[model samples]
Target chain A: MEIRSMRFKANASAKLADAGLQRNLRKAKGKFVDTRAVAIKEIDDFEGTRRAARDLRDRVLKDLDLWLERFETQATARGATVLWARDGAEICRHVVDIARRHGVKKATKSKSMLSEEAGLNQALAAAGVEPVETDLGEYILQINDNEPPSHIIAPVMHKNVEQVADLFAKTHHKPRKTDIPQLTREAREVLRSHFLTADMGISGGNFLVAETGSVALVTNEGNGRMVTTLPKVHVVITGIEKVIPTLEDLSLLMRLLPRSATGQSISNYFSVLTGVKQPDESDGPEHLYFVLVDNGRADVVGSEYHEMLRCIRCGACMNHCPVYQSIGGHAYGWVYPGPMGSILTPLYAGIENAVDLPNAATLCGQCSAVCPVLIPLPELMRKLREEQVERKLRPLAERLALKAWAWVANRPALYALGTWFAVRYLKWLAGGGDRIRVLAAAPEWTAGRDFPAPQGKTFRELYRQRQP
Target chain B: MRVALFVTCLVDLMRPRIGFAAIELLEAAGCEVVVPEKQTCCGQPAYNSGDRASAAMLAKKTIAEFEPFDYLVAPSGSCADQIRTEYPGLLADDPEWHGRAVALASRVHELTDFLVSVAKIEKIPGAFEGSVTYHDSCAGLRSLGIKDQPRALLARMPGVELKEMTGADECCGFGGTFAVKFGDISTAIAAKKCDNVVATGADAVVAGDLGCLLNIEGKLRRMGDEKTKVLHIAEILAGDA
Candidate 1:
């Protein structure tokens, strides 16, 4: 939630040098791309499903206020409390108040990106109520003094098995265990008691079904079930954009979400809760709270970046991004990372502070291609870069160079003369070698590569000579 | 078809042979090709840098320069994609050039795409004997959907064996100004790309975009691995290598 995206380049440079992290990234690189490809290949009409999902999301976003009001009405009618928060601070205030009212000394939590975005755990801790992360990955992060989640789906993806084992060993004061099943069992054993004794449970909403007045949660781990079912009071915190018009729309997104996420046709658990448990009902929470948080999403609705609201947080963009693959997620230096982070950070955090986020991309378009909702990430990044240029946020040298180049490019004769002179200058710089190790303007271009020496003559000159 | 060649700035100044090869290939395919002298840069550096004004200025100049031809083709996919896909949007706000920009966009084509889709050449006019792997420039491969077009043309060459490299579609880190701006990250990405190209043991690496070729080739040369030569798709198709 903190605006650290200004440090993205420096963070990436540091990340690139960490061999352990690089090895982790390399090992996990192609798994997402390959699995998603296989899952997509099995579906006969995957594109049709994507289109359906996109259309439904677009429709919901078009009249988001109406949908949110409808959802609130339906949810309230179903014997659930619906509360709206204008921003992260407001959400934290409401959460802390609710926790204190419930006499909640500790709260169990499922993996929730909304909670991360709001810095809710820190807020809860400040309010004197401990928040126990129930999801294994999140639990590891929480136990490690709340280090950031690197990837959305795989929070501790930056850590290897050995690192996790070391973390668990240090936390539990037990002998180090390296085997995954044993480690998982250890985590389960440690978390089982917290799940039973926690006074409250908090989870993130995957989708808010407007028609049925239910909140949908899809997770691979059993912890979401435990977090929702064990505590007397249950709270779901999510963005305002998660509302869907119908269960049918929810079904369309379901087919795409898990497949695009971890290549599962469906996650292990899909919980659709309409309301709190009735007097006669068993094995459910006594109260439910739906907190809708609007940080900056309302401003994005009609803006040029409205399409970004369609994201379902499947993270297919991050998984397929070559830049993300190279440097890993921490380099993004935010709650979100990878391609989606590049767009969202600038918008959510001030663009002035996060200008480097958009410029970091190579305009590869891999993120958009794999995006189930088909957000044109590269084009949006370009737009953000243009905003920077218009704001004069770029280096003075670069801006002046671009302006000078554009001036010459607009005139044919000037461009011709410029190219001829530039080619000759480059040839002289090369010193008759086929490769030039350095250039006067850009020493960085020659840092790790040899620039090809320009040919002695420009093509315009050659063409003129050939003309009969 | 009478085509006007928009020899991109990099090709014109750094690699004129690519421009010559493009003209040779077009003529051999039974199309009358004219090299337009007024054409300069495609303005991608400006466009990608978020300087839309310059991008628009260059786009309008390019549109007017090649307006008379039935087709406007370029050897670089990044440049061609700029003219074909981005020009209309770049000039959208301009009352004078908006219509012309959009009209010119329809006539614009990357050289390989033009040869395969428009000219309908049965085969490349000459033979290239070597095992060459192809690197797909991000702009060309994703923007123009040009994966099969170059491969389809390359398949027609009698003696050329296409040894595919792993991660060929990955970016070569030469995102124009990005190479200088994010130099370390760019070089790191290019290092990996060149590693993949070398792993294939191909005698040469061919690509449709010269920007990517130059980046990959520069990295290879820097690493002292000059066994694998880099050539544009035009040079291979023209058999001028």
Candidate 2:
């Protein structure tokens, strides 16, 4: 996808003004938040599980190469081809190469963020092969001029039912269905033929178990099963960080993923695909391939951001994030969105390219509090800000202002004098009113809300007078 | 106990009464309170903005000034959190300062946390006759585990009724500089917070941090809600609200 993270401010402003997007965001936010709360409450030891998951992820990331090689050995032993890609372009090349070798015409795809990262659909189209998104959300986005998904889990979360109904009517040339079940049925019926006729299936692996060389695909809708099983070829496109040491670990993570994601104790379908179809197997893909893409993920290991690699992509962070809730994912302007996206977009896409992504968050700590794997998202963002400062990526004015504030703050007498004058000046600006209706220095703040005028005196001044 | 009150820069300038109210609460809890005049900003703006050098310089200064006190307390949870949690990490590379930072961190506490846990005050000196919905400022609620301390303190007041607001623990978007940097999004987030605050129909909306209170109050007034009171926990506990 195009990296428009540089335009975060403009994108956010446009999104905030979008009433329809705001309504969709609110509705989706309520559902995701309420369900996850109930689901988490059901767990007897959610914290302990989170800790165990973190340890497991950290252990794997520590010896990531060993785990990946083991996974390759096991997968190769089962007659599945495992390919490594250094970046998104490499990933596209591998997938397109595989498609050409297999004489594949159309590929049915389950929702995979890695593919979105690779721009795989566009690449396939350029290679003269068709890509059909089977996930209902992805399918909607695909039919709607291949619009980039605003959310990782719910691609069309920014769109309301009315908009979807209108789109379906225009695109499908069929009667519009307003209700959800009817609309879902219409989509399912439309996607059914594509699923059967597609020459290849592509999926994003939630976790690749090294012990068994199985790709664990979890989805609420049955699209994952169709995308992986119905076609002649099946290819798994995922990040190298998705590999885990054991199936036992997958069991623990599986318990958390669905609950943290959509609040289900378990997804509707959980598929563990190993290698190709066995001789006795009647219905399975004839060819199985794994494309483990290491696009900037290797640099993060052992770095300050290693914890970010532990993300299960449950998206609980974004669901609870107030900033993300206000402006839907597209404003983030990348494949990834929300708090995790704030970190990933900068790391994967150059930090200089997406400078605004890190600064955009309030460092509220909600993202860290709700993360199933316990990634310290806010802390990571703060570290990213530190990186920005070191690189001089932040605006010159901001750096100078902070430097000036720090200089004054270090001198107690100067700070006291500064505050004393500043408070009085602000109070004067209020013109005896409790609130300052206009703050010339901060037009951004005054654009929406009034700045509360400071009290007439600084606390230190009042306290000194009260003494004796 | 001799407690040094780290009057956060915001409390010092925006609403000095909160600082005075905090001193009142501390004195009522049987401590000799001293306002360290040398204290300025907690350097959160610098630290959060990624200016580590300035943050460390300020942290070192704060540690030196307040280390003499038996305990150091702050009215704002964010500043207390910066002192208690962030200072050590910020100064980790400096051996002498890191040790001092660690020592100071041990004595640091947010006002309500110190009141309920450290001071163990059984009776409240201040009284309020109205109901209030509490806003859990982000840092205090998540970083400091301050969810129950403030509520516990409020419960001690005889006539106070606590009405819980929905998503009380969510951020009010007054994330220090975040309010001004991304003011539109901050306002939208604060607008949602105001909706929850107003929905309770309580006499007032209260939080431990003045930053959040100011944002909520400012946004509430912008939304034309002039009636719902926004207050700091110190003001309510000190009978200054």
- Best DockQ among the predictions, by candidate number: 2
- Could you tell me every candidate's TM-score relative to the true structure? 0.98, 0.99
| Per-residue error (Å), model 2, residue A316 | 0.5
- Give the TM-score of chain A in candidate 2: 0.99
lDDT of 2 by residue, A71-119 (tens): 9999999989999999999999999999999999999999999999889
Candidate 1 per-residue C-alpha lDDT over A334-400 given as tens digits, one digit per residue, 9 for 90 to 100: 7889989999888887789888889988888888888999889999999999999999998888899
Give me the TM-scores for chain A across all models, comma-separated. Answer: 0.98, 0.99
TM-score of 2: 0.99
Top model number, TM-score: 2
Q: Which residue pairs in model 1 clash with each other?
A: none
Worst 10 residues of 1 chain A by lDDT: A40-49
**What DockQ values do the models have?**
0.80, 0.89
**Candidate 2 lDDT score at position A96:** 98
Which portions of model 2 show Cα errors greater than 4 Å? none
